[model samples]
Target chain A: MNDISTWDVVRNLLDGVLWTLGLSLTAFVLGGLTGLALLFARIASTAWLRKLAKAYIEVFQGTPLLMQLFIIFFGSSLIGLELSPWLAAALGLTLFTSAYLGEIWRGCVESVPKGQWEASASLALSHFEQMRYVILPQALKIAIAPTVGFSVQVVKGTAVTSIIGFVELTKTGSMLANATYQPFLVFGLVALGYFALCYPLSVFSRRLERSAHGTRAH
Target chain B: MTYAFDFASLLEYRDILLAGTLRTLALTAIGTFFGLALGVLGAASRAWQLAPWNRVFAVYVELIRNTPFLVQLFFIFFGLPSLGVSINEWQASILAMVINLGAYSTEIIRAGIEATPRGQIEAAESLAMTRRQIFLRVVLAPALRKVWPAICSQVVIVMLGSSVCSQIAAEELTFAANFIQSRNFRAFETYFVVTGMYFLLALAIRQLMLRAGDRLIGGRRT
Candidate 1:
């Protein structure tokens, strides 16, 4: 067997990084939209809708992301839909992301003072209008930091998709480790690749959090 | 959809599932115990600014927090052998879970520690308390109480994340699901049942942690 050079491993892992980034971005955007809808259902006037949303969030949050991917990937095939690993990974991560994001944003929404809700109601605004025009606007500001913070989780989460056979960084690292017989170097680079992706978001999230608190202090 | 669900097939493998469940629980218990202990030590070191150790822990926390747990598991299980530090899959899983939870709980506990009032520490100092005495007797309990809910949530998250331990063939609950499905060719039913099992486990752990927190820290608050 020909020996794989270190440069070749690094170059190949960089290719995996793009797929990881693509998957992360796809999950985040799709998840954010779905999470927004779930957030609305969660805080809606109807008790049943709120409970339904709560149950959805609880199930997704309670179960492992790997299991979710397995169910979607394998379950879909059993039910006659042959989903590609890409589709399965995206769908699973999207659902997982939505549940957590919905819950996070829900906390932010509830943190908006009760007075804002009452004032909007006193103005004869409909529930939807109150949320769309007043409550969500305020919640959006507070939600920014946590939402950005969660994006870091989304990036880290993409690594799990590799288990479903998506050739992302982690999967690529494993393959290269096997070929090169250099597990330490391959996996170390894999961890560093993720750190490069996630650390900036973490720092940015902290900065946003601090500035948020700074404004609140005044 | 032409497929008929067959959860009954999984029942025949009940022993496998049971063993797997116990293994998963055992891993989580061990991980949580040592992880939280490590968190306490790291948090104290960082919170008190204990020189070199503080910097060491800061880098450790950042490294663990930023990377995915799967990669860490891979490094410990697959990577370490090359460095002449071999560990079995079970040991590697436990180690990964402990380290992952340790980094997170450090940050979580540190937040709690940092929130301790300046006057409280000063009062403890005036009472002629040593540094360790002040940290343990006066500062630790309330800080833990404040952060107990967050800690509980992180514990549950780590528990759920433990499902990935199956990747390295740790023979946990998810591993049982994989084995059952591969045998019966009932992937959907197997995974579905196991997911339900995980949901129940998560709920049970959350409730248990809540009660544990109340007993450990709640009474002291009054």
Candidate 2:
């Protein structure tokens, strides 16, 4: 609908990239916090909370990310509610990210040896205190590698947000491709942009993994 | 806030929705079958280090791993037509899916293969087993037994990823939702129902896979 140069199209996409990053950051931070709460709920003393959290994780993890985005963005509007694309995408991504992040963290928590948990319990430490002081510190070490690895997934998962008409990087590329008759150029640039966003996390995940394995060996 | 709740439009499109779901399952099954075969070969190739072939195998994995699936899909759907291949969208979607599944499965199976201890191979060879016999008897089966759970998870991912093929106008679940949304302006409701359908489908798939996996693995720890 807008007559514009290739550069303008890309620049517009660059501006949209900020929103994409913004959405990812908000989702990561909020989802990370929510994920921690979920991790606790999943493994702590209360059996009921653990079951509820497990169900939440299964529902989110089992379903497709695209479907989750559709539900929050489209499902809400069906029931006499209006949600802005930004709000809907954020909500959807947040929930999806939380389940994954929660699981990732739980794996880290479990990686702390059974001996450590037993030691904590034998010290007359309250369960909360055991988690707060002894168990978490060790688990955090094991957790960092996978957490970083999961971040790469989180970045890639954000690409699905484009389907919501959110005007993010992929959406921009689609619109530009439609206009420019340059599907290759548009998507190539979009792919490169994604690689740029995701590659660092990938590298970091690998590095963390190598070191974590090294430490475990020691 | 004043929108009337309507199930009539969805009911009207029930046949279309059912057809879409069937197509979705067909696409997943085809993609999974081919992808697994390709992945196993790729993994075997990489594991045995077939010289330059191994490098080619590495390049294939790295390239597919780094790029987005949407880009890959378009390269098949839109780009292939330009290159004088007039394949239909469904064919193109499955073609792209096969490649994607192959790359991912290659990595997974390669991991499984490498994790098979060397002693097992030696032990099989000592039994006067030929290379083929050793690989089939000692390596592949046990490796698959070990990695099928992870492989199953990736298969689920590939299945979920099929919904994106709808962008190319393949008559899949997401495409059905898009149709209902555009036709009735029920963007929200259409997507909601479709999401529920996917959740249900995914559950059914997991249950089915779990049973098969249990039978395959059979009291062996995953």
Best by TM-score: 1
What lDDT tens digits, residue by residue, belong to model 2 across residues A1-218? 65777788779678766776788888888899999999999997889999999999988887778878887876676675788888888888889889999998898888788998899899999989999999889888888878877776676677778887877777887888788776767776777777777777777888988987887646
Q: Best by DockQ, which number?
A: 1
**lDDT per residue (tens digit) for residues A58-142 in model 1:** 9999999999999999988876899999999999999999999999999999999999999999999999999999999999999
DockQ of model 1 vs. true complex: 0.91
Model 1 scores a C-alpha lDDT of: 0.94
Residue pairs with backbone atoms closer than 3 Å in model 1 (clashes) = none
Looking at chain B only, the TM-scores across the models are: 0.96, 0.93
After aligning candidate 1 to the native by TM-score, how far in Å is the CA of A18 from where it should be? 0.3
Q: Per-residue error at A56 for model 2, in Å?
A: 1.1
Best of the candidates, lDDT: 1
TM-score of 1: 0.98
- lDDT (CA) per prediction: 0.94, 0.82
User: Going through the candidates in order, what is the number of backbone clashes in each?
Assistant: 0, 1
> Which consecutive 10 residues in model 1 chain A have the weakest lDDT in total?
A209-218
- Which lDDT tens digits does candidate 1 get at residues B1-222? 477767788889999999999999999999999999999989998998999999999999999999999999999999999999979999999999999999999999999999999999999999999988988878888888888888989998999999999999999999999999889998888899999999999999999998998887774252
